[model samples]
Target: MAEREWTTADFDYDLPPELIAQEPVPERGTSRLLVVHRTPGTNPPREDLAFADLVGRIPPGDVLVVNSTRVRHARLLGRRPGGGPAEVLLLHPLTGDRWLAMGKPGSALRPGKQVLLGDELAIETLLVRDDGFREVRVVGADAATAIERFGRLPLPPYIARDPDQLDEARYQTVYADREGSVAAPTAGLHFTTELLDAVRARGVEVVALDLEVGPGTFRPVEAEDPRDHAMHEERFEIPDTVATAIAAARGRGAAVWAVGTTVVRALESAGEPDGTVRPGAASTRLMILPGYRFQVVNRLLTNFHLPRSTLLMLVAAFAGHETTMQAYHHAVARRYRFYSYGDAMCLI
Candidate 1:
């Protein structure tokens, strides 16, 4: 049999609109977990479990690397000088207090215009790009102070709801420290303090890496040819402590597991061609596709991804393409919740 070309359609799967979780489960660690076994030509049955049971899946001495990039209140609500509603999502800060962001009703906002964000909060457009993104410098207060005062949680668009006070806590992971991501590392959101302690009690080590997931993470892949789509660049850092932990795990013949796709990218980005992880901080546009060799991550714990998303492709690349699709089929058949605030999958 000839090998199939992995196109965007190949990664697509049917999901019911109602199955997309609009709200998070009230209990953080009470969500469902589906364990998928990845092997060539093996259609292994999915194991049903709860999030709290996750630690048992990892073997002793394994190092689970998690992304500690916190989700900021990136959604800023305001009005144009003409009194029209304007929404902005800060992507990442650039040099000289400038930021790259995407704004709603962007067609109406021209370069050299100012948008008023609540009382004493405003932004001046520095440049408007062909892609519809704006490079703007916030006026009045600095970024951090302004975000705290006027920003809202940048929830996934599929949720079909506005950010609430509860989302400020429920949407973030317990271990999140550094703030930069516009979206939550959904997989990590399942981990509670008790769960982390339990994992440590079972001899599984936890390590942290930083990957500032950008606004592009939420953008759907619109290209027919998956490979033709350009992956967005996100800043990532693998601290020396994390590098040391991974090296120590390898030294002990232990598997290095990634908590989410963000961790997978960070670990893979820091890995040398020979598969050794080096200490480094850099921006990665590493697009993980089928036939790509994974050097660092031995296992992945992630949430169900959108059809035709780069996230789904990364999971397919980590797990076998056929195995991943089969798992997705099983998930859909079982009516599992999909996307952010959805059920999880652990592939080993």
Candidate 2:
């Protein structure tokens, strides 16, 4: 039999509005974990467990890859040159003092228009791109300092509230180091320092890489056929040290576990046919739809994603479409928190 052609609708499931998590849990590693097994012929057994139980679930000597991209204070509150309310969501840097950003009240982004960022800094529009990004030049201060001093945390729109002090800490991972990403790698949010220590004690090698996650992570798949959707590109870096560790683990017959979809994209983009990754910095637009062969990651830990989302499609590719959909339906029935601040599912 030949493979079936799947559409965007085939990858979606019904999720209730109430299940969408508006806030993070009181503590890390306390969220529920749904373990989905990959058995080809039968309905896979999904064990509902706590996130802390992840240490026991993996075999020793496996390489655990995580994205250490830090979420920057990308949401900036500013005003137009005439004092009308203005907002800028910094996506990434372009050149010296210039950044790729999206602004509100599109009229405020005309060439040479200036948006006063704060008492110390302002941004002047340089150029606008077709994809809704504006090339703006910083004035009076560097981009980093301006964002740090006055920008607010760029929480996703579904949260239905402003970013508070609590989000300052809870929205990032414990090991987050590189300052780049606009959105949090939610899968990594479930981990705690104690849980990591426990995983290390179990003989698993934890490694990190940088993939500056972009706002595209929150976009839904609008095309009827998922193949028609254009995947977003993001920058990623895998150092030689992490590459050597991954090769050593694979040589020893150990599995490579990806902590989140962001890590999956980085690893697989650098992945070679032999399952070893090439260490270097690069940007990727790799879309992991069903039928795409995974080169590096063996086990995956990810959060519950939105319906008809690229993240959900990537999960379907890894865990089998039937199994992934089954897991989502089960999660809905069981009321597992959904989206960025939600519970997680581990596919083994």
Candidate 3:
């Protein structure tokens, strides 16, 4: 039989708007979990459980990799020169208080002018990008400090509401400590300190990696051929301890579960040619489509993604394409929440 050609449309599904999750569940461990068995012809194919039941789903002594990059308050609402409304979303931090960010209505923001975030925090526009991003220099205060004072949580656009006070804690994972990412690793958001303690009590090996997610994560693949879409390079680091654990687990024939798409990207990007994980700090632009082989990440735990998104393609790459499509249809039929604040699907 001849192999099939895959396009961006081949990876999409219809999701009703009401299923989009606007807020996180009050309890972190209370979200619904849909477990998909990867084997062909498995009876029932899907199992529904609470997020807290994850301890039983994972095999004992297996390695679980999580991304610990914290979600920063990256969306700044400010004013342009002459009092026009302006918005800035910090993308990546550069040296000496400069940052790469996307400026709203960027067409009119001149390079030499400044955007005022607060009474003392101002950003001087250094470069105006044709793609709607701006290179700005934080004039007086540092980027981190300014964002902490004037920025809101940079939630995905699908979530159509202002963030509430609870979002301050709910948007971040319990283990998130390193400050870098603009978006939360949504899959890890389901774990509570108590739940993590339970996971450890079950003899699971937990490892941490850092993948600094950028604004490009939310961009849709617009090319006619999905292969032509370019992925943005996000910085990542797999510490030596995590790398050692992953190598040992692989040697013993144990599985490694990546907590989110970001972790999947990081582990796969850092995989050695011999199939073992290596420790290092670097950036990755690796894009996983349907035909791309995964070098690491034996199992995947991820939130439902937007239709036709790169994230959806990555999920399809890990799970079989047909299997993932069926799972999405099932999730929709059951009215499971969708997108960043959505329910989870664990493929094993």
Worst 10 residues of 1 by lDDT: 37-46
lDDT per residue as tens, model 1, 91-173: 88889999988887875456888779877879778898877788988899888887889888899888999988878888999
Q: 1 or 2: which has the higher lDDT?
A: 2
**Tens-digit lDDT track of model 2 for 112-168:** 888897666887889988877799977898887888887899998889989898898
Best by lDDT: 2
lDDT of 3 by residue, 68-120 (tens): 99988888888876788888888887776678888776643558878887678
TM-score of 3: 0.96
Query: Which ranges of candidate 2 are over 4 A from the true structure?
Result: 41-44
* C-alpha lDDT values of all predictions: 0.87, 0.91, 0.87
Clashing pairs in 2: none
* Poorest lDDT segment (10 consecutive residues) of candidate 3: 101-110
lDDT of 3: 0.87
**TM-score for each predicted model, relative to the true structure:** 0.96, 0.96, 0.96
